[model samples]
Target: MQIEPFTLHVPQTQIDDLHRRIDMTRWAEQETVDDWSQGTPLAALRELVRYWREEYDWRRCEAWLNATGQFTARIDGLSIHFLHVRSRHENATPLVLTHGWPGSILEFRNCIAALTDPEAHGGTAEDAFHVVIPALPGFGFSGKPTQAGWGVERIGRAWGELMRGLGYARWFAQGGDWGSAVTTAIALQKVEGCAGIHLNMPIARPQPEDLAAPSPTEVRALTALQHYQDWDSGYSKQQQTRPQTVGYGLVDSPVGQAGWIYEKMWAWTDNAGRAEDALDRDAILDNIMLYWLPAAGASSARLYWESFGSFAAKDIDLPVAVSAFPKEILPTPRKWAERHYRKLVHWGDMEKGGHFAAWEQPEAFVRELRIAFGKMR
Candidate 1:
């Protein structure tokens, strides 16, 4: 497994082509509703597209990623891309942070400097971590899986190998969204040298017994889950059922791709009312570029088709820590989480943050990881 250092450099032709496509976008009719009831509002998206074409600098994002250490390794017959930032603290615990669908390593970029050098970011050396942020197979710079079975379980196994390959005898895992599912899979598999795992969006589901006599939190959680299934799950359903069909538009039209993910950024983040409220435009664009530059729309969504139903957390006896973000698509209540995570070591209900916890709330996100892993460390 040869690991090679990587850098970011999108071909000029590709950038030119993106600009041309954005310019030639044949827009659809605007929604009748006053708000985001339908999807990304046309006016909002038009402004974003304008900025994306005229002002948003992909080169800056590229340079930022290049400055951060990056590498690609052949793992499980696939070329996996990851950002490996070692902490100055020699004894820092190794940690593998994974990103989910509609997300990439960009989600963790802001937290890297803080995590790897805690003292530099207002924390002690004890809080430092040697962080490894992997672009999930079929996302960002990672090679797309040509065959099936590159789901959460397989990704989890690959992450174990990745940690070992990087010379870490022991490590911890942290993630949210699809990342949470992958982390849970790692815990369930009892990956060697995995000290523990931390999750922002835990995959605990209300069991039949719990639904019979639900607690107040469980009732609220269940209601939210139902709402998600009814409304917000269209993207999941489309991806699970016909990723190839959706891929055509997303891969071809930059606007189509942006709209698909932009809506989620709005719906998922704790942005109060708009995505820009919580996350800056550049951060959001940086994330979108991960998909746009790589044309990973279909490949990223295929994980849903492969492992959506299989992601639920089961009874795992390993030490597990969970941080439940309030505005998450479906926040897992502590009581519900306890039912699945047998040795629930840490449970936190954060005041703010949502699906993109690391991106939306880096300070709180870093603090949670430090606190959660401190117990195991």
Candidate 2:
């Protein structure tokens, strides 16, 4: 693997073009709803557009991100962007931190400092770990795979290679959303290079044995799934079948992009009313900008269409830890996940974070990961 510096500098033309798209956006009519429950209410998007065009400053945000040791690696012919910050602790274990779809390397920015140097950040030196936060293939600075079948398993294998290329023989892994699925693949294969695994968004689809117990926890988990099937899966359906169609609106308009990203942030965070209360608005815009500048809005969504169905069928063999947040659409019960993971070690029902736990509550997320992996140690 060849490592090199990676940074973004959006040109004047692209910024102007983004503004024009924002100006020319064709608004779709919809009834007033609570915090974009109805697919990014057109009105709220329009307001967001104003801030994005006139108020938001991308260069400043980029500079702040660059301070965190930005770099790129050509892995399997894809250019992968990541922030690598190693702990000073000589005994710190190498850990891979992977992010999911509709997200970027930015998700892990908050936890990097604490995870890498726990002793300096009010944590035991024994809790330290060398953290590798990689942007998934095609989501950000990472190269977008142009062909098909580049699923979670492949990504997991790539991660294993990434560690070896960096001269590490073993590592712990953690993921959220698609990242969780990738961790499952790495763990199931018992990747000799991987030592333990932790996940936020479980990618193991339901199995008969998983639902067999019918315990209160299992029943509640099933109910969540049933509800997700009814009211929460519109984005998945579109992404799976015709991501290109959905991409057209998202790439062309800033408001459209904001709405697309905002709905997820709102639905999946530890927030009650204002998303800003939980997620930094600037962070949200930075993620959207990654999609907008690359025009990868559609290409990324195709991940769902291409690989999710098959990936959902396999079971993981390693010990796994899961943290479930209340507002998430289909949070699996701990007992249910234990069926797939033979060595289920830790489970947490979180009151403070949702889908993007790594971003919403960095302290809690890092603490959980340390505790989970520390047990394996």
lDDT per residue (tens digit) for residues 5-98 in model 1? 9987999999999999999999999999989888899998998899999999899989988999999989999999999999989999999998
| Most accurate candidate by lDDT | 1
Cα lDDT, model 2, residue 81 = 78
Model 2 regions lying over 4 Å from their true place: 32-37, 203-213, 310-313
Candidate 1: where is the Cα deviation over 4 Å?
none
lDDT of 1 at 41: 94
Worst 10 residues of 1 by lDDT: 310-319
TM-score of every prediction relative to native: 0.98, 0.93
Model 2, range 116-149, lDDT digits (tens) per residue? 8897777898898888888887687678888887
Go through the candidates in order and give each one's C-alpha lDDT.
Answer: 0.90, 0.79
123: Cα error in model 1, Å = 1.8
Candidate 2 displacement at residue 138 in angstroms: 1.5
Q: Report model 2's TM-score to 2 decimal places.
A: 0.93
